[model samples]
Target: MNIAVIGTGYVGLVTGLCLAQVGHYVTCIDIDTNKIDQLQKGHSPIYEEGLDKLLRENRQQKRIEFTTDYDMGLADKQMILLAVGTPQKNDGSADLGALFSACRAIAEHLSTDVIVVTKSTVPIGTNERIQDYIKQHAVNNNAVSVVSVPEFLRQGSAVQDTFHGDRIVIGGENTEAVETVAEVYQPFNIPIIKTDLRSAEMIKYASNAFLAAKISFINEVANLCERAGANIDDVSRGVGMDKRIGNHFLKAGTGYGGSCFPKDLSAIIAYGRKVEQPLSILECVQRVNEKQMDILAGKVSKRFRGLKGITIAVLGLSFKPNTDDMRNAPSIPLIQKLIENGANINAFDPAATETAKTLLSDKVFYYETIDGALKGADCSIIITDWKEIIDYPIKLFKKHLARPIIFDGRNCFSLKIMKENGMEYYSIGRPAIFPIS
Candidate 1:
């Protein structure tokens, strides 16, 4: 199968490479000349594990190419996958400016019948609108069928997810269109789920909303456990033992953040309002997460009687580990709040410092090494549980900070270990550890 993937962001790049690996000739199109140039040289502009290697292999095999010209990229393509970004607007609705612009370009250049599969997440009825828009604007009378085939790739591990995803969804009003899309994924050997266009669009939003709710739910539970003299780790373990609740996003932490959750939840909630189907539970989920992001900042302030004139070492800057995405990262708001209270921040993340620099203030200091970041700080806070930070020597915390006090958001250290090491430690939903006298 010949495929054209529009937009070379995380979704588009991974989709194109993985599809090319599975015997499809893929042309990745992007407006960014720098990104296209990098892709042409077999370099991935984004830092995804295993992406650059796959890009190199696919390019070597002549299975993939990159270009900025729509006519050249879309020539004779059987499927056009729209992987453009539908970012959230101020009103919490999707800003479809990029998606629409891509559609218009495709309509003007398309000269053959093709299945236009939307991998971009959109509102429920947006696919119908896309179909009409493309047909109305097409320069040639080509049969362009619009299908909603939303992607379910997670950042940092998107390549692995694409090869081993649980299911592939193909949604279209036309049966022939749906089957053609399904055939494209036949080489993947994953189960294909067929649905109508609206349901397919709704599935992407509903899945992300539910995952965000789970994270918020566990964070709320962690707060209760802290007040009730229980450990969230044990509680999560026991609760996750249930067959129905087999624990995937149940770890209690500083709430969920990334490119997907925050905006998707807001977009869906706003959609609910527009349609008069109020999603009260999801509304609460959003509220809970907003508070959860501040939990660590509040803890640091209260522990120090306020953050005035304090120098704190922050380990980890990205929302989660294994990727360099800093969109809506909890550390952004936490650092801002600390700075507002007059605390100085020295932060370190293995992969996110470059991206973090754009989102964080100039007042915060960046360090290449975790120990370097902790050196001479008054205290420390663990924002992300990166492997580097987690496996660092425990005694180093005592040697690095002026006072051996630690606030851990991800519970990366054990209470017993902190107590035995003669350090004061606080972690989510666990008893505070004070050094044994």
Candidate 2:
């Protein structure tokens, strides 16, 4: 199969590489010359575990190529996967500027009947709208068929998810269009969920909204546990034992943050609003998450009696570990609040500091080493549970900082260990751990 993947962001890059690894010749197109150049030189612009290696292998085997040329990418391609970003707008609707641009380019360049499969997360009726848009602008009305094939890949583990995802959702207007799209994924042997176009788009948004709701619901439970002297870890485990819940996204923390959840949840709510049916629960989920993002900040302020002039060491800057994505990362709000309260910030993440610099600028100090970031810090905050941070030498916390006050957002450490280590530890839905007198 000859596949053209538009956009070289995490989704497009991973999709292209993984598809090619499965024996499809893929041409990845991106408008950014720098990104294309980097891809051409065997470098992935985005940091994804196991991505660059696979990309190199695929490029070496001539199974994958990178280009900015739409003509080259679209030429003789049987399937054109639209992996472009459908960024969220102010009202929480998807900003389909990139998606529409890709459609127009596809319409102009498509010379044969091609399956235009969308991997971008768009609105429920977006595929229908796309079909209409292409028909309006295409050189030949019969040359294209729009199919909604929303991607379910996670950010850090997208490559693995592509090959081993539980299922794939495909929606199209006709049997030929949907089947052709399914044939591409037939080799993966994953379950294929075939639905109409609207339902397929809703599945993508609904899945994300439900997961985001779970995170928010757990965070709310954590808040209750904190007040009620209950441990969320214990609660999560006991609850997870039930076959009904099965314990995915049940961990209570500083809340869910990333490109997908925030955007997709909001998009669904926006969709509901546009159709005159408000998703009250999902709306509250978004609100709960926004508050959860600032939970650490609030803790810091309350603990330090107004963090004015306090030097705080923040461990972890990425939203989640194993990737450099900073979009909607809880650390952003925590760091912003710390700064607002006049706290001097020193933050460290193994992979996301450089990317964080773009969003956070010089507002916060960046440290290469966690110990370096902790050195001379008045108190420490853990925002992300990176493996290195989780496995960081506990004794060093006692040695490096001026005071051994640690606010852990992810609950990545054992409460017993923090207590035994003689640090004043604060975490979500757990009893505060203080040194034994």
Residue pairs with clashing backbones, model 2: none
Clashes of each: 0, 0
Residue lDDT tens for model 2, 328-414? 888887788889889999989999989899998486999999999999999899988899999998899889999999999999899
- The residue-by-residue lDDT of candidate 1 on 127-202, one tens digit each, is 9999999999999899999999889989989999999998898889999999988988999999999999999999
**Reference-based TM-score, model 1:** 0.98
The lDDT leader among the candidates is 1
Off by over 4 Å in 1: none
Model 1 / residue 72 / CA error / Å: 1.2
Q: Scored by CA lDDT, what does every candidate get? A: 0.93, 0.91
Cα-based lDDT at residue 36, candidate 2: 97
Model 2, 133: alpha-carbon shift in Å?
1.0
The superposed Cα distance between candidate 1 and the true structure at residue 225, in angstroms, equals 0.5
